[model samples]
Target: MIFRHTRLIMGTALLAVALPAVPAMAQDADEARIKKLEAEVRALQRKVFPGGDGRYFEPQIDSSAPVTTTSSSPASTTAVTDILARLDALEASLQRLTGQVEVNSNAVRDLESRLAALESGAAPAVAADNLLPDEQPLPAAAGPAPTPPPAPAASGPSAQRLAAVQAIAKPQTDDPGDDEYSYGFRLWNAGFYPEAQQQLAMFVEKYPRHPRATYGRNLLGRAYLDDGKPREAAPWFLKNYQEDRNAERAPDSLLYLAESMIALGDTNRACIALAEFGETYPAIAAGRLSNQYEANRKKVTCN
Candidate 1:
């Protein structure tokens, strides 16, 4: 009877162990089936959506079948994480593309605006005539005016007699004689700017026949410039250049003329002046004005 009891106990223990192993084997088989289904789903996704990174996974179970909570939860969480990551990556790519497009759009707009501005003819003015026709001509004296005769000799060397002798002995200065050429220099030295201007203008008008008149005109323009009036100086500079292109002061006057035109925003005229300067006086221009000529040449824009 004891042997029969021992056999029954051993059999019960063996059955308990065997029953636990049965569920384990079934679980392992189910896991392998799940792996196979996953591989098939991956292949189908690759075939349906070629070259696409998006993926989908589904278990092969009847609609009415009960799903184990623990098995489904991990897979569902993994799929959700993968989808969220893919969505974030897609959004990042879209943002980068959008930024690039915006940059290109702004560059195109800037170029279009530049083209429009160029087409609109917003350039320097070309006046009807550079010089005003109605402006005052330089002053000129009618040929030598009649001179008054010397008064009768005074009796003695009184103040009036001395003054009369002194006046008579003083050489005639009204004439544009050799002394007149130095009039501008004297006035400048004496700090008489107004008188210097008048004398220089008179020299330009009356002594235009003189060889030094061209120099005087240049000085007159410089005088106006020293007085802080480039507009007023430009005409005299132009006249000096017109009167004597080969004068010693001609190139200087032309240079000043270009400067005046630049001040007046007359870039076209400045360009012309620069070109003329380069062509007319090559030696002096090459030495002194190369940079200015190049700058003005660059500033010129033609339609």
Candidate 2:
């Protein structure tokens, strides 16, 4: 009976040790699996949110204590539920912020387009429905009018001449300010030199800082030259060239100025002007000026 009692006690002690060891082995296995799952989750997060700089939420588990098969206490379950609820709220807040960022980005692009148009002296594009019936533009004339003969040279600008130069009325449009310049350019091309000069003068007065201001000034000089007033044209050409040498019309103004100087019996200055034109716009094609540069060069006999 004593031997049987001793055997039973030894068996009980061995069972106690074996039970604790099994739990410890299970805890170690669970920890290894959790670590492997965490690594995979981190890799997925890196791909899903490359801009997040590895930031993410991970639930904390106590590694110091061994896990068991026992059911969780009520307090622990409640805490886990609260944590899940907070994570859901955080996800919703992030979505709202992302939406707001997209909206702001669109607003910024719209503002930039408007600012660029304003700087370029171009009116913003209006929807067709927003325009009034009267705001509709009339069809441009099929052909330009015949050019009149050049006026006679005068010792000075007369009162009648000045009045004629300022007589053309500006037309009204939905974007009247912008269209006024176009109207002047069309009138000039249509051979209405006096009216063109007047309209261009008005444009310069109104939109002094406009992007097309250089074009208006250059065309005004051409009007004076075509009207047989070389003396009057020279100053306008000089002004256009001096104001903005890089303007698209600047080289043309210089070329015309050289022609005007020749007409005014200043061949030395004309030759100098032609030299400057060649130096400033070396790559400019002859087609751009309708071969006027070559013709002028022949007239002055430049070397």
Q: Which candidate is the best by TM-score?
A: 2
Q: Global lDDT for candidate 2?
A: 0.64
TM-score of 1: 0.39
Tell me how many residue pairs clash in candidate 2.
0
Question: TM-scores, in order shown?
Answer: 0.39, 0.43
Residue pairs whose backbone atoms clash in candidate 2: none
Writing each residue's lDDT as its tens digit, candidate 2 over 159-258 gives 8866654564556777665677887887787667776777777876687678888888788878878877665566667667766889878888888878
lDDT digits (tens) for residues 1-303 of candidate 1: 546544644654554445544578775755564555454444444443444333433433433455333345577789889999999999999999999999999978865554343222212343557647743332211223111123346743468644643343213365654345566756645544545576677666677778677777777777766766565676677667766788888888877777766766777666566666776789877777667656655666523
Candidate 2 lands at a TM-score of: 0.43
Clashes of each: 0, 0
Which 10 successive residues of model 2 have the least lDDT summed? 137-146
